[model samples]
Structure formats: structure tokens, C-alpha cells
Target chain A: MSAKIRLYVEHPLGAGQSVPLDRDQAHYLFGVMRQTVGAQLLLFNGEDGEWRAEVAEASKRSGVLICQEQTRPLVLPPDLWLLFAPIKKVRTDFIVEKAAEMGAARILPVQTEFTNSDRIRQDRLQAHAVEAAEQCGGTYVPEVADLQKLSRLLDHWPEERQLMFCDEAEVGSALALASETAAQAPWAIVIGPEGGFSEAERKRLHALPQSHVVSLGPRILRADTAAVAALTVWQQRYGDWG
Target chain B: MSAKIRLYVEHPLGAGQSVPLDRDQAHYLFGVMRQTVGAQLLLFNGEDGEWRAEVAEASKRSGVLICQEQTRPLVLPPDLWLLFAPIKKVRTDFIVEKAAEMGAARILPVQTEFTNSDRIRQDRLQAHAVEAAEQCGGTYVPEVADLQKLSRLLDHWPEERQLMFCDEAEVGSALALASETAAQAPWAIVIGPEGGFSEAERKRLHALPQSHVVSLGPRILRADTAAVAALTVWQQRYGDWG
Candidate 1:
């Protein structure tokens, strides 16, 4: 059987390359997973593709793995970004994990006017993205941007990327992606906070030329649910799901 | 502003009708939520539509609510069922909650050949469904069926209900719902366990005339993510999302 354990490392990965493991990684591979010398595993970095590596040296605090061969080439996801207001801790982690598994190229947490949580642990969220990528068998991991204000984000928004604004109040516009906007690359999906967007924020979003205001459905979905639904909808219509 | 709290109760709801809250409900409304006499809230039973209610009598252990008027008529979801193999505890609960929020008419836990968890707490999952419905502002709560063997479920499968079988192995057949089957009511989506379906199980599923084998995407998603993604896709094409 192929390697069941997939690890995300920061070192370069190629045939004949040796990777050194940190203390945490050593304990995880040796003590927790019960791996020894010559055990096979898959390794991947953001820049490199997946590689088949075997334990060359094993110890309690540190170890080394030598890459044997390239198992899979680097496969980048579609140029799609997910921007959502961070909710509770667990739900925020869920969103990041789901975003990585669903092939999001980037994840941005924006602080809105009614956002419940003002600050977010970007490092923690980034670690979640890495774990998700590892567990989901993804070759590339999405970058998690630090939390920023929604107004500033909109002001400095990339002009080329279209925004799929999920308007919870606009139940009538039922996600008619075929007619609303042409399915294309370089897209972002924006989900609001629990209390939803202020009237001014909605008006500003509506006035943006790059925004395609749409609704998930008739029901009032929670912010987390909205994120997943919006990602699924966007991926199906515009991304690489098809 | 309208009532911010939506609750699911077992009692009948109607104009001027008085309903008694159980101990847990009384504790939640009166003690936890700090709601007193004259406070208004929205209530829904499985059979009745959502009704606006006023607190007639309030105490720490008991309370009474008088219905004011129907706020939302019963908006039943399309005839869709979600069949999934139970994974970890938190993920299983996540599946039930998402099923309720995403418009599944029923949720079934099936024990497949590769299923790790053979038994599930039906009552706990059902409670989660109710909570999800209450939080999502859904007037209808879907039923959560007890765990059963996959073979038994297939033996008595409904002929009219088409099955959207999500085969993780078939990465080639992208989810082409439009071409595979005509979008209609009375459909079900089946997601396998983390280990995926056994070969025999896959063969049987493929042999079934009602099964439409499809893939979520190129990346392998966890069971919970697959459930949500499959529901979103099926709802967008076959259910009431349009």
C-alpha cells in the first residue's frame, strides 16, 4: 500500500533530497505514529509536488527522511479566494479547513462592522489550512491572510478578480450564476458575519463594479453554512469542480 | 425588531393557544436567555408553521407561551434524503446539522462494509437537527433515521427515488447532474465512509439502475465536507435552491 501518512514540510522536496524533522515532527512520526527507519511517507511543500520519502534516520527528538521519488506533480487550484468574517474558534477553523479541501487558492478573514470577533489568530488559522491540505491529499496549500477591515479590503481589492458577494438579505436573487456572471477564473466569494452587513456596507458592495451580488437561498443560513454553500456554488459554476 | 429567538417545541402552535414548555425549554428561555413575561419569541413544531408567541408566565422551572400569530408558513424542503456513513462523533453531528440547514427531508446513517462506527445515537443527532432548524430559521425539521446496514437499505430502496451516489474512486465522472439524471424531487445523496466503499459495495451500487455515480472534485474531501458539498450540489440542481 502507498504511504498513508502525508506530511506538510517547509523544506524543498525532490529525488535524493534529505529533509530534517523538527522535535514536534519527530515525536509525531516516531512516538505517536510508531514509525521507524525506512518507513515510507508522502511529503509536500507549497512550492514542490508530492514526494515519496522514507525515514533515513529516526530518534526521539529529531529525524531525517530522504526523498525517493516524485509521486505527483504540483497541481494548483483555481484562482479562487474565500473571504469570510471569522466566527467562533471551532467554526473559524472549520471554514479554513473546508476552504483548503474545496480548493480555495486563498482565504482572507475580514472584520466587518457587525463582526462578532475583532481579532483572529492568523497563525492558528494558517496551521489549520496546512492540516486540511495534508488530510485532503491536496498538492498546494492555500495562503491564509491576516484579518483586515472589510472597508480597507474593498478599497484595495484586486481589479481583475470578480467578487461573488453572498447577500443574505437578497433572497430573490437565488444564485443564478449562469445569468449573473460568466463563469471564469480569478474569483472571490464574500460571506458576511452573523449579524450580517450594515446597510451602508451593502450599498457600497452593490455599487462595486466587480461585485456580483447573489443569494444562497431563501432560508437564513448561518455565516459558516453560508461560506460552505457559497464555496460549493462558486466552485461548481466558476471553479474546477466540473 | 422581530423576535430574535426561534425555538423548536413539541406543542401545537396557533393564535391565542397556550403552550407549556418542558423543563429544559423553560430553563433555556427563562433562566439561560433571561426572557421574562411579555417577551416575544418564534416557535415551530414539526407539524405546525412558525408562530409568534408571547411569554404568558415565566419561572425558572416552568413557563407558558401564548401564540400571537403565524409568522412563517410551513416551507417544506424538497423530497430529498441524505444517506451517509457515520464518521467521528463531531463530524456525525455536523452532518445531521448541515442536513437540516441545507434542506434535506431526511437523514439516514448507513453502515457500509467499510464503515467504522456501526451504531449511532439517533436521539442526539435528531436533537442536533432540531437545533439546526431553529438556528437556521427553517420552519420544517427533517427526520433523522436510526442507523441501518447499507445492504438492508438498498434491499428496500424506493424505486421512484433516484440516488446520487458520490463515488470517491470515480474521479473521472464529474458531477454532471444535468446529463446523468433529470433534476426532480424524491432524490437522495449517499456519501461513503472515510475508507470509502468496498469493491463489492461499489459494484452493487453501480449495478443499481437508480444510481448516478458522480465525483465531487479532484481533491479528496473528508466525509463531513463531502456531505455538505454533495448537498449543495444536489440542492442547486435538483432541489429548491434555484
Candidate 2:
């Protein structure tokens, strides 16, 4: 079996590097998980590759781990941003977790015209991303940005990045990601809210030169399902996982 | 806007067909949603197409709906079955919901050697599938089969149906669905449990003639994520999501 305990840390990792655990981490490792001194676990600090670490000190409120060897190199995901409208609390959490596991480079919650959720807890969602990365054995953890307005983001959209707009209205249309764009290019997938994009938002997205309005399928998939489906379609054709 | 309430009924749907609502359905439509007489809603019976129905008789204990016109013909999902080892309760419900939303014709919970869940509430999972169909505007709800042994399933595997085995061990291999198999063929996708497949099971699967071992990506995906990802990949290439 793979390493059962993989953690996302903040300290830089190298051979013989001693990393101090916070109160919460210490409690989790020593008290909750019953790990003693010299217990081995994997650690990744987002920038550094994964490392095999052994517990150097174990206490109730504090603990330390010393890096033994590098397990895997940092493998970054393709330059893909997932822009989605937040829904219910549990489903929004699901979106962030799945995005992190599915190899999104960055995740941005966009407030669209028909979006029901106007606010989101960025810290909690970011923690979910980190937890997802830890569970999926992913060395690279994607950044989860704070919620933002979709219209404003579109106004200052990057010229190099292609926007994949998942339009529920565009059913029966082909997913032309592979045919229209090259692989490994800067791309972002935008999924609408549960209420779907408004007429004006749809018009604006269709008029945008960088936007590629593609359909997931004939059926109207829920926003969460659409996010995963769009990511899968894009990854299968344009990103890694070929 | 689309129909505010979409219900799955067992009665035949056609013009002037009066369908009786069950006590549970009545409680949901009347008590919870507060629908009165003449409230218009959409209904589908899986075999028949969707129909516009009006509350012809509204009572505290029961109700009746009169079907007016055929709104949409029955659009059956692709003949794809999802066979997965059951996981935790919520995640198992998620897999069933996603399978119904993503257009799986049938869902089977298989017991693998590494599978922790030995028994599952099949009726509860079936209700989840119905709820998913109701929310996603899907006319057909996939049947959730009872838990069975994976080895027994493979023993009686249909010769004509191709098996898309999502093997986490085969990470770097290409998902050669398009090149290896023809579209619209009878197919099934099998996802392993959280602990993954045993060595004996993997050997047997690899030895199966109809098994197509494919990889989702480089990183290890959770059981729920893998189910959605595998469905999306298969649907895009060989199923109905083109």
C-alpha cells in the first residue's frame, strides 16, 4: 500500500530537514493517529517534491519530522483554471475537492448573474484543496482563489488563456477542444451556476473571442457534474491523462 | 424556465392519462412544496416520454395529475452499466447520483476483496437515483442493483459487452477507447474500491478478453472521483457525450 499519512506542510523540504508541526498537526499525528517517534509519513510543501519523513519528536502539543528521502518530483498540472459558480455548501466543497484531485492548476469561484451564492469562505475551501491533494497522492496542490465576479474577471481576462464555457444551451454541439486548440496551452473552463447563465451572460460569452462554448452532452448536467465532466473532457483531449 | 417540479411516476404517460400519486409523493408535493390544485408539473414513467401534468385532484392524503401533452420523447441513456465496489454511505450515494446524472443505464455495487462495504441499502440508493433524475431533468432513472461479488459478475460476463476496467496500477497507459472499440457498443465501466483491487483480481481482470485496462490520470483518484472521471472519459469517447 502507498503511504497512509500524507501531509501538506509549509516548511521547505530536503534531506535531513527537520520540520516543526503545529499544535493541530501535533495532536493529529501523535494523539489522534497514535504515531510515535520514528513513524514514517510523506510530506509535500506545494513547491518541493514529495519526501519521506520520520518523526523525530512526538509530544502532545508539538512534534518534529526529519526528511529522509525524496519520494517523487513535483509534477505540475497543465495551465488550466477551473472557474465555477458556488452552490450549496457541501456541493461547493465537493467541487473544490474534485478540482484539486482532477489536476486543476487553479480554482476560482465566480459569481455569475444567476448565481445563488454571493459569498464563500476561501480558507475553508483552500483547506479542502490541500486535503484533496494529500489524499490523492498529488505532490502539487492547486491554488484556490477567493470568490470573484465573473463579469469583472472577463473584462480583464488574460489574452493568452482560452476560456472553455460549458453552455447548457449548446447541447448537441461537439466538444471541439482538441480540434480548436493545441495541447498544454493556457486554458480555463467556466461552468455556470445551477440556474444557468442568463441570456445576457450567454450573449457576452458567445461574443468573446477567447471563449469556446461547448456542450457536456444532450442532458442538462448539474453544475457540479458539469464541472467534473468539462474537466475530464478537457484533460482527456488537451491536458494530461492521454 | 423549465418545469419547476419533475417527478418520476410508474403509470403510463399519455394524453388524458390520470396518474395517482403515492402517499409519500403526495406528502412531498403537497405538504413540503405546498402545491395546490391545478399546479402544473412535468412527469415521466421511464418507458413513456415526459408529459405536462396538472394537479387535477389535491387532497391531504393523496392527489391526482392529469397528463396534457407530450413534452419530450423518452430518450434512453447509452447502454452503459457502471460496476463499482461500494464505499462509504454518502460517497456511495454520490456515485449513484452521478451515475444517474451522467447517463448510466444500470449501476451495480460489486464486492471486491479490498472492499470494506459488504452490504448496501439498495432501496436507499435507488431512491437517490430517482432524486438525481428528478433534479437533473433526466427522463430515465438507472436501476441500482444489489451488492454482489466482483468475481461472480466476471464469471457471468456477457461476451458481447466490453469492460472498461479503470486500473489505477496502469497509470501511464493511454485510454485507447476510441482506437480499440467501436462506439455505441454494449459496454460497462468498473471502478475499484478505496483499497484498490487485489493481485488475484487484477490478474483475472487482465486475463479477461473483453477487459480494456485504461488509466484515468497519473495521480490516484478517490473512488467517487474515479467513478465520475471514468464515466466522463467513457461517455466522451465511446458513449453518447460526443
Candidate 3:
């Protein structure tokens, strides 16, 4: 019933390598989590596989951990990205956390005409991604990009990456998504804000050759729920879900 | 773009039928939502199809509406049940809310050996289910059953209903779930708690003749996220989603 706490580190992880903890990490392990010297926990740098680390020193504000052994190999998530328009503060955080846990390699926040939030706290969101990875036993932490306008993002969109446009107005089921060629091409799922995509934005997305408008189901889902549902369908169809 | 406000009512909806609203509903429509007499909105009673209703009377503590026409037919969710061990209050509410929005016909909270929460507020959860349906534009609100011990529920388990047991120990993709018979039969998706099922519980589930062990994906998901993933896979395979 007890699982070792997993921490995300920015330093390299290797045997005999001593990793320094920042003030917050030290506070988390020592003050909040109540860990002491010699305590063992897993650490991942999103580069190295997860490593078992021993608490060499535990202080209130600073500490160090020495790597003992590699517990798990670094397993990268699929080359998939989740592009969504930010909604309420809590819901936006929910989307990022779920996307990280559900195996999205990257997350993009898009600014559409109906988008409510003007800006996003990128650092905060990236930290949430890291926390989600740590909690879900994921070795890789997906990067959360700065918010970008939909038009600008579309202009520089990667042509080869298939875009699974979750259009609320779409009529058919998403079963056809599984029939798409299961190639090694990268993919992205775009979810609109609570107000949905503007007409112009929808037209532009539909015109893109790489974009495939797919429906989630018979009912309309909130933005955060749509993120999970779309990611699930995408992973089941082509991503390494199986 | 303004979507009509949708309300859940208990009265039958028909042409010229006056629907009485309670104190909270009246305050919601008049005070918070700023709707006046003659304001049009949608209403559903779970038994009847969604209907367009016009406010015939409006007050801070009470209101009345006249049904105009049926907007949507009563479309029942697939005969799917979501059995899960409740976790934290907010996450448990999230699971029920999402289950209702995602088209689970019924929700059952199970208590396993490893289940952390000692008790669950069934009425509160049911209210959350109704709120979710009201917000998501769902006509059919899934019933949130009171918490029951997993063992007891398993003993009286319906043999006709196939249980898609989401075993965290199971390896491989959920695509295998799609291969199960696509006949129109009852189905249930079982999700354990954060601690997961005990070895004995897992053994019992595996031994059940109607249980099919399936993995959600490559990564291990938390209880709430796992619920969404399992439901998505089930709907895509046998439910009304795809």
C-alpha cells in the first residue's frame, strides 16, 4: 500500500551521481513529505530512466540525493501533441495534468477568437506537467508551450503531422479514426474553448489537409473532458496505447 | 454565440404544460442567469425528451414555465454501468460527473479492501450527476447508486452483463476490448481506487466468467483518469460512442 515517492529532477541521473535538490524539492522531501536521511525514492530527469535515489542529506531548505540504481528505463510518450484553447483556471490546469498523464508528448495552448483567457502561465503549467508525470509513474514529462494564436500556429503547422480536429459540429462517430494509415507520422489533437471554435477557425481547420474533423460522441463535452476523450481515441487508433 | 440554458425538471413536458420551478431553480434562472418572463430555455425530466420551455412566471424564490415543443427525443445512454471505488471528494465527484456526461447509464460506487474512503455521500453525488447533465446538455442523467461492498455486488453480479475489468496488472492495449462481441448487451467498467485492487480482489475478478481483463494503455493512470480512459475505450468498442 505504500509506493515510493517519485520526484522530477533537472539534473542527470546515474549511478553514484549526487543530485542537488532545490529549495522546494528539499522542502517537499524533508519538511512536507517528512523524509529523512537514508530514505529512498525514485527520481526522473525526463532524460535518464527513473533512478532509485537515497537521501544523502535532508535539510529543511536544501538536500542532496545519491543515485543508487536505475529502476526504470526512460520511456518517451508518443510523438503526439495536445493543442487546446485555455478555459477557466482550474479547468485549464486539469487539461494539462490529464494530457500529461494520458501520454501526450507535448502540449500547446491555442488562442482562438472565442478563447477567454488572454495569456497563460507557462512555467506554472510546465510544473503541473511535471507533477502529473511524477504522480503517474511516467518517466517523460511533456513540455507545455506558450500560448499562441490559432492563425499563427496554423501558418507554421507541420504538414506531416496529422491533426485530429475535435469538431463539436462533426456528425459522424470517431471509429473512422482507427482506419487512418498507422504510419510513424506525428499527430496532434486540437480542442476548442468552452465556446467552441469560431466559424473562420473551423473553416481554416477543415481546409487543412492534415486535419481530420472527428466527433467525440453524441453529447457535447466540456473542454477538459474533450481533451481526455480525444487523447483516448487518438491513442487507441494510432498511438502506442496497445 | 449564446446557447439556451438547460434545466432538469421532474414534471412531464408537453404543449402548454406549466412546469413549476423550486426555490433554487428560480433563483438560478432569475437572479444568477438573469432570465425574465418569456425567456426561452430547454428542460428535460429524464423520462421525456428535451423540450423548449418559456418562462411564464419568474420570481426570486419561485418560477413557472410553459412547454413549447420537444427539441430532442429521449435518447437513453447505452446499458453501461461504471463501478468504481470512490477516492477524494472532488475526484469522486469528477468521476460521477464525467460518467454521466459520457453516457454511462448507471454508476455504482464500490468499496474494496484497498479503497481509502470510508464513506460516500450518495445524495451529493447524485446532485453532481444532475448538475453535470444540466451543464453538458445531456438529456439522460445517469443514476448514482449508493456505495456497496465490492464482494457483495460481485456475488449478485448479472451474468448477462459483461464486465470490462480494468486490471492495472493486465498488459497490452485496450484495443482487444473492441474484439469482444458487439452485441447489444449490458456492460460495466470496473475501476479500482488509487491503491488499486487487492490480490484477492484481482483473482476473483479474473476468475469471474463474465469478466474480461483489459488494460487502459501503456501508462498507469490514477483512478479518475482511469475512469475516463476505461469508459472511452468501452464506448468506442460496445457503447454508443462509435
Candidate 4:
């Protein structure tokens, strides 16, 4: 952890290997961040663990970094997915960023019957996830899946993965579903859009054999806040936070 | 629960009573949110429970609502406070807004050694708190205190109140502080600024008799995310969410 500046790179990292930086990475390191030849930093490639690398060559639009040693092993997030309908642009970004920071392994933007937006900019949202991981000192970045219809996703739902269906209408279930899941099982947390789930959608979710409708709490949370809050509680109850 | 719109008002609410709105409130209700005469909504005054109300009159700069009846009794939040060093403008607002939505009883902005912002707009932050409560259908609005010195606040800290000190440096304390606090005792979650706590400040917090240093998780989080995560975990472990 000698390198205070950590960057996520796509190249394979190993000792005595030279990693080439793309134009954007070169400009970010040399021009924007003021990194230079001989400067040290940490790099992670999602496959390899984090590595300590030193600038071997610096240029305006190209650079090279020589991996010195491994800094940290890759720490994968929990076997969890965040499934939600995209809301407003900014809040949707916030949900993805917070989900990345709060230990979600995958981010899924679901399209429900009442979901307002017809489509989402998948590339933009994925970039936000990457940026969140970079800023939050995370070694692993969650994949941001392209938007999918909730109905289709439910039709192909993995029976092995427990679904923590967060519903405001089921507020007083007496027993929180957080307690029922086995600690190591694959799981996903589903949150609706601002308009919430339609009657048919709610009924379909309630009838799922693997779905566990969990209440977030007594208070009504906006869709974005509910996503972060759900991740936090789940991490506290059974994720890596414990 | 029948009312679609929720607004926070300062006037007393009861059956057949009129509640007047200020210019901003009127503009929001009449112009932005488009509530016209005879339109029904929900109102809460912090002092009273939520009440169903109907628009009695609509105007350019002022309006009135007559309370129909009480819809919900006051549900007091757990005696929890969120204390954190103010960061950048948008994030500070986000922290206050989420704290209000996540069941924090009070919000305190404390000056610390590593705090970058010299001062905060208390009124603006408080407005954000109110907005969050209104949007989340919260019956109670947490008071946002003006910025105060951490040392002075600690000096006057109540003995009965327990502090959950979120420290990245103390990441391996397997037992979460949430389990240590009594269910109904006054509690506060302290999050450091973006630059994190100075060594001396961290030492002082660790030495405090009332403070229990706890780790958020293996991964590092931004200051705003940490505040929300802390509140969420607290609510899940011991607060009203249970």
C-alpha cells in the first residue's frame, strides 16, 4: 500500500511486466493528475490483484508503467445483485455509485410495468460504476448490466439465488427476510421505481418461490435512498461488512 | 396513506383547521407541484401526526389548506444522531437529506481537524432536510444544527449517549458497535471528512469513554456514503427498522 494513488487499469499486471496506458489514462495520469516518470501508483485489473506500479515512461498521450509488486489481493464483493428500475438520471447514477461502494457485485437496471424511462444509457451508467470504484478504494468493480424488463428477468430468475424483494406495501411482515437467507447463498435485492410496482407485478413477485419480500423499514424511502439503505442493511446483516 | 402528496408545514393541524402556506410553499404547491383548489394531500408539522388536507384556496404567492382529519399518529424515530464533518456542498446536502430519510433524530455538522469547508449554509442544509422528510413521507423532521467544533461538542457530550465512531483505521474490530448500544439509548454515528480524521483527532475519539470505534467494512467509502451506511446499519441492528 505504498502507493497513495490507486488507478484501475485493464492490462494484466505482474512483476517485471510493462503495462501500457491508453490515451485517456495517460492524460489522466500525466496531465490531469500530475503523475510523472518514476512516480508510483497502484493498479487493479479486476482479474489480477492490485499491484504497485511505477511510471517507466511518460508522454502527452501515452505512458508505460512497470509493475513492481502486488499491493493487495482482489477482494470480490458479496454474491449479491442490486435490481432496480431506473429513476431520474442523477438519482439513478447515485444508486449505481452507492451500490458499487456498498458491496454490490452486480448492478441491474430493471424495467417494470410502471418504470418511467423506456431505456437507459448503459455505457454512461457503467462508467459511473467504474468511477465509484476508483474513488471508494475498491479493488473490484461491479458489472452494470444493460437494462432488462423485470418480467423477462423474473421469468428467467435463478431459483438458487434468494431474492430480497423490498416492498413498501409489505412493511410489517413481522419477520424480516434478512434473517432467513443462508449467509453464503447467492442473493439479489429488488427495488421498484418511484411509481412503485404495479398490482400484477407485486402479485408475481409475491408468488415467486425464491422471493422473500423484506421491508426496508417503517419510513418510506425514495427509490435511490432505498437502494443504498437496502445494500447497507444487507451488508450489515450478512455481507462482507460483518 | 391515501394522500398522494406529502408536505411539511409548521402550523398546527386538526380537523377543520386552516393551515396557511408561505410564498415558497405556495409556489411549490401551486406552480411546481400543481396542486389546485380542492386537491387533497398529506401534511405533517413535526409536532402533530400526519393529517389529510385539501387545498382551500390557490394563489400566486399564498394558499391555504384545511385539515380534514389525522391520518397517522406520531411515530418517533429512534434516539439516534448523525454527526459528521461537512464536505463539499452537494455531498453535505446529500448527507443531511439521507440522514433525515433514514431515521436520524438529529443532524449535527461538526468541525474537525481535517474538515475542508470553513462554514456551511445552515438554512440551505435545513431546507434539504425538510425536503427529504416531505418526499419520504416522514412525520418527523430532524433538526440540523449549525456547525460546531468537534472538541467543544465532545466536551459537552451527554454521558448516556453512545458514539459509534466509524474509523477506517479500525477496520478489523469484528464486533460491530451496533450490538453494544442499548436499544433505546441516545446514540450518534460520527463520520470523518473526505480527508479523514487527523491522527490526533482519531486518538482523541478512540480515548473517549462514550465512543466506540467501529469499522464500516473492508472497502473504503466516501464520507457521504459512510453516513448513510452507518445510519442504515444502525437502524437495521437496533433502531426502528427491527
Interface RMSD of each: 1.5, 1.2, 1.3, 1.9
List where candidate 1 sits over 4 angstroms from the true fold. Answer: A176-182, B177-182
lDDT of 2: 0.89
- First chain TM-score for all predictions: 0.95, 0.96, 0.96, 0.95
Which candidate ranks first by TM-score, i.e. highest?
2
Question: Which stretches in model 2 have alpha-carbon errors above 4 Å?
Answer: A177-184, B177-184
lDDT of 4 by residue, A122-237 (tens): 99998899888887878898999999999999999997888888888987553344434445689899998888899999999999887777787888888878888778767776
True contacts kept of each: 0.69, 0.70, 0.79, 0.73
What is the TM-score, restricted to chain A, for candidate 4?
Answer: 0.95
Computed on C-alphas against the true complex, the DockQ of each candidate is 0.70, 0.75, 0.75, 0.66
Poorest stretch of ten by lDDT in candidate 1 chain B:
B176-185
User: Model 3: per-residue lDDT, tens digit, B94-163?
Assistant: 9998998888999999999998776899999999999999888888889999989999999999878888
Which 10 consecutive positions of candidate 2 chain B have the poorest summed lDDT? B176-185
TM-score of each candidate structure, all chains considered together: 0.97, 0.97, 0.97, 0.95
**What lDDT score is found at residue B112 in candidate 4?**
98
